[model samples]
Target: MPLYKTLTPNSQTTVKIWKITETYDDLLEPISLKPENMKRVLGMKSELHQRGFLSVRHLLLEFGYTDDDLFYDEYGKPHLKDGKHISITHSFTFSGVVVSDGIVGIDIEKQREKIGVIAHKFMDYEYQYLDQSDDKYINKLIVIWCIKESLYKLFATPGLSFLQNTLVIPFTLEEASTHAWIDYQDKKYRFDTTFFEFEGFTCAYALPS
Candidate 1:
């Protein structure tokens, strides 16, 4: 059980992270998944994905929930049966979940330079503050990307564009937190974004503020 970290951001929210080191069989041993989730896990082509899926179940147990208490909306956003907001993320060997009283979203992404090549596809206003020549460019990009992803998951609205609609305010890597806005269909929403890094991976989460 590589339960890496647990964080209580507020009285009504909790975040849990898992460092996956268990084999597929080992991970499958403890939790009994609902039939649909079991079939979903079995149908995953990559064993790494399977393990990440299973580790999330363990995270749910840490919060006293199970697969039976979870469901996905048409947009694929996860929901708790008790009506609490839930957001989930996984990347490489890490997986995480955020349960909150308000709308929330989370994402974990492996830091890599490859993101630079496609930065323009999902970035617009952020370009004003990004210095491609800076040594921390990749890290900065990853944080912004994760921030947008979190907001997207929180919104769960179809046809939203990361580049056009989601905007992350200027912030330095040292800040580790910032503000973001979603402007779509003549409506504006705001969220507080926070980020952290571990073992070459970056995790970002957001909550309606």
Candidate 2:
């Protein structure tokens, strides 16, 4: 029953986020799933993942979509039959869906100190301005990770390197928005990414800049 927050970044895009506060059964009971999706969710070993999967269906319902309207390409990027662009992301306690008239991506992640431990793997250019001593360092890192993840979802191409091919422009938490680029396969792309934090989690969405 928790529909959570909804967003309209522009006239053509909508973002919905669900805060999971229901038992697996409660989430499962309300929505009808495609047979394959039912089998897929039931087979998930982690209850967290099971709930995450179900919550996305609820988000889809908010957008007036059902599993039948969704499909995955060979690259595993999700698509809507009506030709609108879409991307989805789920974390430990939240799930997000972004539907747009143009290309878009969305992600939600729990903000934690551990992100700094793995920052090296996905971050490169931003390191020049990233200082560990800053109080907002963790928050900034989470935003960068989410931004890169959103771009990855939008690009949907294999061999896209977060470290080598993607870069997040410098910004403070107060700004809440930045620009990023994807340099892959000898082509370059740009996106405008925005992020916000809630209940200890960070969620970001990307749209073509």
Candidate 3:
């Protein structure tokens, strides 16, 4: 019942969203973070980390999988017993998952009032189109951030930064739908993005070109 939207980027991939609420059954269970994930969650600022994990677990349940059904390999990528390509994300009260027979990715981010200081780290050519001085800037930034995060999750690479890589092409944010492309090792990827208001955050998912 958590699916918010479904998208088909190509004949081979499908991406879906889930809005995890407090009523979600898994929210009450004690978190059992794996040692590796614990390293990051334990050091995180608390609420964000806990909410993220709780959301992810609930999303798995929506798919008929449980917390015990997930395992992370040495590369830090999560592996499901069913062997599907998966990506997980949570921001504020929203969490999302993208699963595909092929490679997939997804991301969700809290719509902050201001992302001023950190903008430079993620905004590149997309900056020219952005009216950072405008009141709508934070929402615009979240759109770009979610798209980049999806691409990162899709590739599962370590050193790529949104500012230097992830090309969002060009699109109008007018109708809550956008298109983007990413070039990874000479391969071009096409992504279709849609922004939805969910639990006070902006959520997006992407798949192969």
Candidate 4:
């Protein structure tokens, strides 16, 4: 499951996911990293985080990109040398990337009951339809969190608060898609969002509408 999945959201965008089933040495063996990234990875204190970082490089290769083609801004959002938009995320054993000609974002998050304990920290508007008593409560919360994170990565604007600035329109798992908005600085930006569950995690992505 090194390359767990791939998505072509549109002709101009691509998404790749990797399941970190490889050891650090196994993943590093095939990668060519610039000195800075090599040091960053070497300084990681957790093997899980280290493997997650390397797995993303593998995801980049799946998209026909090399580590050299990617760079980050002061806000920590990723950019491509070719000018395509790119977003990266990894949680536990899974890592994902989305690259596009236009603004785009993607995220992967493991569903956990703890998310419910802090849902209020990042939720608004969504409360109108959410019911913690439902069996799918935690699942829905994870979806919203991942969706907001995707939008946040796309926005990458400082002072944008997830609880106050982003909203995921009402949706059910079966629908597989929904409308999301980022209301920041008095500007309301809409996005076409999609999500799916794999194993125990949720992955969501957003593109400007």
Give TM-scores for every candidate, taking all chains together and pairing residue i with residue i.
0.98, 0.97, 0.76, 0.98
Expressed as tens digits, the lDDT of each residue in 103-125 for candidate 4 is 99999999899999999999989
Candidate 4, superposed: residue stretches over 4 Å from native: none
TM-score, model 4 to reference: 0.98
Alpha carbon deviation, residue 186, candidate 2 (Å): 3.0
Residue 49: error of model 4 in Å? 0.7
lDDT of 4 at 152: 93
In terms of lDDT, the poorest run of 10 residues in model 2 is 1-10
- Cα deviation in Å at residue 41, candidate 1? 1.2
Candidate 3 residue lDDT tens string, 16-75 = 565555542356354454566556555667665566676676667666677667887766
CA lDDT of each prediction against the hidden true structure: 0.94, 0.93, 0.69, 0.93
- Candidates sorted by lDDT, descending order? 1, 4, 2, 3
**Clash number by candidate, in order:** 0, 0, 1, 0
* Pairs clashing within candidate 2: none
Displacement of residue 127 (Cα, Å) in model 2 is 0.4
TM-score of 3: 0.76
Off by over 4 Å in 3: 1-26, 29-48, 185-187
